[model samples]
Target: MTAGRPEPVDRQLPSDEARELLALTRDLVDREVRPRSAEDEAAARFPREVFRTLGRAGLLSLPYAGEYGGGDQPYEVYLQVLEELANGWLAVGLGVSVHTLSCHALAGFGSEEQKRRWLPGMLGGEQLGAYCLSEPQSGSDAASLRTRADLDGEQYVVSGTKAWITHGGRADFYSTMARTGDEGARGISCLLVPAGSEGLSAAPPERKMGMWSSPTAQMHFDGVRVDRERLVGGEGQGFRIALAALDSGRLGIAACAIGVAQAALDLAVEYAGTRQQFGRPIADFQGLSFLLADMATRIEAGRALYLAAARRRDAGRAFTKEAAMAKLFCTDTAMRVATDAVQVLGGYGYTRDYPAERFMREAKVLQIVEGTNQIQRLVIGRHLTGR
Candidate 1:
């Protein structure tokens, strides 16, 4: 859900250079992503080369530090890049977002040495990463995650299962959440686990309704061993780290939702103007025209919401409520806009021959992922109440 209220008047907007990058990102999506997304969707294949292209363009690391092979770009700029990718192809957008989320534990709380060891690979395409926090029983209630990690001399043996893991089998690295001390949120800890670690395995991907191109699997850590140095933060600091990572991650989802909405809108608008009924373009009709207007309005508004939150994050301001609002608003709007886009296309939109049906399916997942819209409401509700 990427929609949020309008930005304050004094807040700085995208700078000249940032605007250029945004244009370039959107251009790349139109040139590369839009043309290829359909095939990727039909084949249910991951476009690993898309990462190579993005890495070569320095787009993958747009939000990270330049010293670590990243662009060190502002969040405002980086989110625009995300918005563009998502607009053309959600799988790539989600892949980028998950990679960024994985990078968070290392960037925010990891020791300098740890960052040096890991950040470069994550920023580049040489290494792919996943964030493991959601469990089968604990999606909205992340505090109930039961993965366990027990110390065994200098090494720790981590054992548990993480559900709904993006890039689960394909990722080279996993930023995992585990229980290391007690019960509830305070007991959790974050660990950086390499894919090749012994006893670490993944179940075959879950049958998902949308985003079929991006793999989702249940990862099992049966006595998976990690070095003491791999600990992301001090003991029992995992939940705090996860929450911080998610605050930013939600903005990514917000941007992705906007992308989904735009994709569906683009299809609907083009189809409305081309496909004829009653001897005229449907775009000529007042009723459908009004729907298109609303769709366009929501897309722009959703973009503004995530951009606003990203700017706040970049400026070191309190933006949790803003991010949650963006996630809540944008994703809901995407679901609605995509659903309506299909209706605008009528029967043709529902067919697999078109992207709208796929977009509709993908939009529903956005509401479920990151944090469900309900969870986002609770976050916003608690913030408003000072809870």
Candidate 2:
């Protein structure tokens, strides 16, 4: 910022103050993200510049080490930033979440050399990343994936298909989970697959009901070869890495859900206050007011749920159940709140003229991705029963 212009935002982390930083992040989102979202969604196009913009702003890799060109902010603050981003552009938020999932493999399990080689471009957002876990035959049961990466004389010759990949061929690299040993979960091994590797190609983007702006596609790995150095952890530890990523990935989706819901509620409240009904503004109606009230309540509850999970994680506590709870609660709340937001807008909500429709579309994918809300409940239920 120059004279007469607001100061450029400070996204750096200092352990002493979080509220102030989050407010700044919110202002940054209002200034940068909210203004361009409509066009981004309308085109169903990925903004390559947005990634570089976030990279320049130092806003993309919160919770990752600054040494790796990340902000190194705590999860609590990182998530609030994501909330504001999603509230502005769901595609951007989902991209960050998927990128984080890709980073999870390196951060949690990568060798020091691996971290050094890969973390810069990723944490800087100079390149996008995708996690290849789900296949056509397996979504929740990722271990049952048919993709195979067998060792050749000097490399692993990989072959199979992965489905519903967020970045797919568009990403610079894929964090792939493939069968490398015997059948079942124990057989899966995680590997790093570069995009455009020989024999690797992504199918046409999915014709989806929502998240149309976020590219989704099926990946084909036809004899793609990778060196042993590309293996993430060990021969049979793919399931562990996959589950570990999901544990944290669930929080990212929860944050995304809360943000979308918040955006929908805000739009609904504003529309209700200004739109005329009967002889006055529709906000005057008790029925509509109550709907707004419930919307606010649910948004607050969902925000609290995700933040609690974030805190528990930062504290080094066992937080699987909490993360799952946040995912389940926030995603469902998003669906309910988005539906209500549409109702508040009447026919306008059902059309592209307003964002409520898009919000609703984006909300559905949050529930389906990361883990289905049903799967989230099963995770929590299992923990509750001490299973």
Candidate 3:
């Protein structure tokens, strides 16, 4: 653990390898990620080299098969790794999550030849990826996307815009969804488009209040030609593939939320213990102590909820509902815990000197991304009512 930060909770690992992986993650975070996080975030600088360092360490591809250059770790272990990274820096952690999500369509639906040709390079960490599903007009209503991919002999001419794309301009490749046939979900298809393709361009990154170190931009495909071989899965299968990937991605978001909450709670507790009031530590007061207790409880609960969802996924169980519930609860908990943390630090927390205010800002986005809390509740409700 970094100096003055709370000790990480003792995690139960299934094997010695998992334990070793956690140790390595902690060392890397303390040495590289945590130290530079505040500086990079404040300047809104994307730390591409840090991502490269993580790639070199095989930390970027933990959940996929080892044969294709992934770590071959289970979801449970992979999520815990994400938690540690998020605790260090939300931008890096969420960037990793988005990259993993971008790879899902190709890894899970591509033919063997396609996987052999592309998966190796992607999972090897030499290249970065972005998922292009949301458009300017479509957010939660993903099936209403208007991006077109007209068939042209052995290629697809893609034209449209993808909004709120993480690593939009910097990614080497994009896993993009486009309308291929009639309107609605059935018309969609997935394609892999390289960054240097002619007619493909990215708009300036969005100006955001938090997670500034992660670039989010809009990508435009103006008659970009993609080879037919780049098509992932069959035509009309893109929506299903996208949904499947989201089930897993939701768990990733949940883990990241818990990590943020834990970090906020740690900061609050450390400050409470050291900052004196009326010649006594503020932590000695019953009012502030109760607040800290509630924050800790919420963090613990959020962690358990995400871990349970991850375990279900690893067990090959249907975890869509569980994933949604986890995403909703954990993100909401993070928002609350981070807000409370800001309160715990009083005036100092509101200033940029401490990270409490930053944490609060970062926590708000988690509730909105990867399918908002409202969408998650809709998913869970549908599952319960079979509607």
Instruction: Residues 150-260, candidate 3: write the lDDT tens digits.
Output: 999999999999999999999999999999989999999999999999999999999998999999999999999999999999999999989999999999999999888
lDDT of each: 0.87, 0.85, 0.91
Could you list the CA RMSD of all candidates, in the order they appear?
4.0, 3.9, 1.2
Regions more than 4 Å wrong, model 1: 1-13
Model 2 worst lDDT run, 10 consecutive residues: 1-10
Could you tell me the TM-score of candidate 3? 0.98
Tens digits of per-residue lDDT for model 1, 169-228: 989899999999989899999999999999999999988998988999999999999998
**C-alpha-based local distance difference test score of model 3:** 0.91
lDDT tens readout by residue for model 2, 289-313: 9999999899898888888899899
Candidate 1 vs candidate 3: which has greater lDDT? 3
Residue 347's lDDT within candidate 1 is 88
Q: How many steric clashes does model 2 contain?
A: 0
lDDT, model 1, position 318: 95
Output the TM-score of candidate 1.
Answer: 0.94
The prediction achieving the highest TM-score against the true structure is 3
> Candidate 3: lDDT of 114?
95
